[model samples]
Target: MFGLWAPERPTEAAVRSEIWSLGARHQGRPLEGALAELEADEITSGRAALLRACVAKLRPAKVRR
Candidate 1:
């Protein structure tokens, strides 16, 4: 888990890696949160740190809708 920084920067590979590992732990598990209604159908496969950040906490998708 990460704390809020005064300023945010681009996500790093290490952070992405963390996201992937977290995702793996909860793979196929159902999550209930504010964004719970959104389908978290897949645990992203690449960008380890980014994935980890995402999995650690629900982050906004890199790609825009």
Candidate 2:
């Protein structure tokens, strides 16, 4: 398989940052629900899932504060 065919997985820190930025854009809405709504607007399912995963992983950090 050629390296070119593979999609790169984002680093955890990068994903975390993306989640934070996205949260800021749509404050008060749950991240998972936001992503789901976005997916209905033509975002790829895979991309949505990846973002959801990032949000889920970072959710505990938000709750601890």
On TM-score, the candidate that comes out on top is 2
Task: Estimate the TM-score of every prediction.
Answer: 0.30, 0.53
Q: What would the TM-score be for candidate 1 when compared with the true structure?
A: 0.30
Where model 1 places Cα greater than 4 Å from the true spot, the runs are 1-11, 28-58, 61-65
- Residue-wise C-alpha lDDT for candidate 1, range 1-65, written one tens digit per residue: 25453334336666555444544555633222212323456533343334334545554458777
RMSD values, in order shown: 10.6, 5.0
Residue range 1-65, candidate 2, lDDT tens digits: 77576656767876777776667776754575456555676776556666766766756665464
Error of 1 at 36 (Å): 14
Clashes in model 1: which pairs? 15-49, 16-48, 16-49, 16-50, 17-48, 17-49, 18-52, 19-51, 19-52, 20-52
Q: How close is candidate 2 to the true structure, as a TM-score?
A: 0.53
| Best-fitting candidate, scored by lDDT | 2
